[model samples]
Target: MIGPNLIPVGIAGLGSYSPKRILTNWDLEQIVETSDEWIFQRTGIRERRIAEDGEDSGKMGAVAALRALEDAKLSSDRIDLILCATTTPDKPFPTTACHIQNAIGAKNAGGFDINSACSGFVFAFNTAAQFIATGMAKRVLVVGTEKLSTILNYEDRNTCILFGDGAGAMVLSPLDEAGRGEYLGGSIQTEGGKDDVLEVPAGGSTLPTDKRVLEAGLNKMVMGGNRVYRFAVSTFVKLVRQAVEPYGFEQLGRIVPHQVNQRIIESALEKLDLPPETAFSNIHKFGNTSAASVPMAFDEAYREDCLIKGKLACSVAFGAGLSWGHFLVRW
Candidate 1:
């Protein structure tokens, strides 16, 4: 809860980076037993970005961070904290946030990582806002980067076709009287006991990597698509209403949602009684980028003038861990 003594935080700038290589649905036809029509009808994705040989999560995050700093017209040294949200960190050690700090030359910033699957970006954004709200930070760089391609088993069409590689970033700072956007508040909910619904079953403390595990493709992403789809459809509506209803529908500019699936998003919007264009989505272009999805969509929507100045914009996301989050912004 925000206290009267706490300072308000606002988004200073936004940026996103998508890899150059485009993997079309037709390409998936060659890779797996799926056709373009089948995939698009189900997920509303026609193509997705594939990171190049040298593009890792850290590098992608750094690029997006630099772009965000440029957009904000602020230097990296001004950042007080760096928060990165990702399921696919460049490495388990040192944290992807550390790599980004070094790469971006954020010499004065302390950094860390947050892993909440696809809900990660919203989680990280809320955490960043707290540091600023408490006056511990004046500028916080929040990044959501994922090199999901690294952990995918391409042969498995179910999960492989649903994710891509990318990064998105935003600079959050204490709101000033003239600030263009304000971070209003947010809500988050997590349902445990559903970790098996979507997970990378191995390479963790519970299931350390082994020769046998590697042979079984245990490190690759596994998902119960139907279950996740149902959860997303319902939870998306709940989260949007929870964050947006208090402010009223007419006051909202746009809903930036985690680009998980086109069908899921559409279903939720229908249930919420919102217009088709009420929410902006790029899943058709980038598939589900996990934590990177929401921020990436934010960047695109802002650039396209979908999120207008002096208007309210809300971001919502959900993923593995059965976790979901939403944040309200007055832009």
Candidate 2:
């Protein structure tokens, strides 16, 4: 139950950025011998974006942040904090949040990064809402940005065909007086002992960057695809059911899930006995952008009128680290 004294937080604005480069399945045919029919049939992705030179996570994130600030009509200096969710940081030392802070001129903002992989955006958004609810911050910028192309193994058709590069951002602020939209509540969870199902094996303390790691392609992402698909299908249904239990499923306006795969989303919705249109998805256009998928889809849904004001909507994601999370907003 919500406390009367607590400040209500809501999404004030949203924006997204995708690189100009489009990698089509036909294009993949030239590089990896994968057919367009096969890829679309299996993953429901025909193409995805690839960042150009110099378009790292920080650069793309800043672009998205600027658009979000513009949409919010809020000055950069007004952001009290920035929480960036990413698996691919521009560099190991300087947090990507700091880079975004400088780029967007959010000089008054304190910033940090969260690396929950695809689920990072939901986790970051929930964390940002807490700051607003507690009176710790009036406004916060939450960003989920990634340049997965930097670490993708083009030769590995299994993983390469399913990922992309992009960024999405949202500005969270106190719900306005008499406004209908407000954050409800949600959950972030991890099924431990399953990290090995999806991960990049090297470039960290456990498996430091080295010539052997490079030769073995440990720096690139690896996944047990079948295992992940099964887990995602079941978990997506479970999270959505749990989130809507308090409000009832019929009250859900839309579901913005991690755009990992079209098949996964469709299958999950099927299990819930819902129609295909119940969920909003652009995986066919952007593929799997990990952390960026949820926010990007959210931005698209709002712009396209899929999300209705005063109705509850759920954002869910699952990815590397074997992590998954979901959050609800009445918007």
Candidate 3:
């Protein structure tokens, strides 16, 4: 059932970045009533990097993007588009991708930012793939960067211990042949009815910032942990199967899931009947870095030679917007 017009898009290069500041579980104990053992057993997170003062999403993204371009052995002038996926953007106007374009001196490209929370990267990847598939762009930079530490409610142990800041980018280019790209098949799904389960209550058009909201700290992230946990585990398992079944499940070589939490990841593996070692994770070191998790893991796995050429690798993630999806890549 392959479409006659189907085209391929492959990753030419990859790069990632994390801020200098490292916040450890012991650091959390100093601020909250949590123990290192409790956090380790619960989330498998020992430490996470925090963006330094004045370091915004765009800056982190630009650094990662530059590395990706360099790795691809391409100059900024060759890039045709930039897609930055982030929830913690620098501002509401100008879009973070535009700022990245200017910072990286990619004057030849025009771009936009996408917000699907932790699922942002998969969403961006799918979007960028379409641009190449339809012959709209040649070289596209797809970046997933976030400075979640900026908006975290430090006083809330439930949320504060679960987030960090970082950025990761990939250089994707069009491939003339079918089934010969960095990715093969993927799908995205959203459940707006569950939006309230994880969201920032203020500072949006629906609930503009006010003195009362600001004083109440309503702008910070809020999460119904149990609800999101349930949804994340189920969605990840379901969509992963959806993406892999089409390619023949037995052909899969490895799984690279979003570094959200150890428990959720373990649950996903259990449900899928896949071994734990088949999945690459860095949540213990980076916590939940939102969109950056997958690419960061991708870079690390690639370096460790966990993702080999012509091997089937599947990436899955779930996040705010109650969105979730998976992508099957031929590495």
The most accurate candidate by lDDT is: 1
Quote each prediction's TM-score. 0.98, 0.97, 0.96
lDDT of 3 by residue, 1-331 (tens): 1146766788887889999999999999999999899999989999999999889999999999998888888899899999999999999988999999999999899899999999999989888888887779888999999999878899999899999999999888865422233668687888887767888989999889999988999999999868888888888888878877877877788888999899999998899898999789999999999999988888788768788678788899999888888777887
User: Which candidate number maximizes TM-score?
Assistant: 1
Quote the positional error of residue 328 for candidate 2 in Å: 0.3
Model 2 lowest lDDT segment of ten? 177-186
* Candidate 2 structure quality by residue, lDDT tens digits, 239-328: 999899788887988999999899999999999988999899999999999999988999899889899877788988887767888988
> How much RMSD separates candidate 1 from the native structure?
1.1
lDDT of 1 by residue, 1-331 (tens): 3569999888898999999999999998987999999899999999999999889999999999999999898999999999999999998999999999999899999999999999999999999999999999899999999999999999999988899999999999988821866888997779999977999999999999999999999999988759998899989998888887787888988889999999998999899889989989989999999999998999999899888777789899999998999899899
Q: At residue 7, what lDDT does model 1 achieve? A: 95
The superposed Cα distance between candidate 3 and the true structure at residue 62, in angstroms, equals 0.6
- The alpha-carbon lDDT assigned to residue 267 of candidate 1 equals 93
Spell out the clash pairs found in candidate 2: 309-331
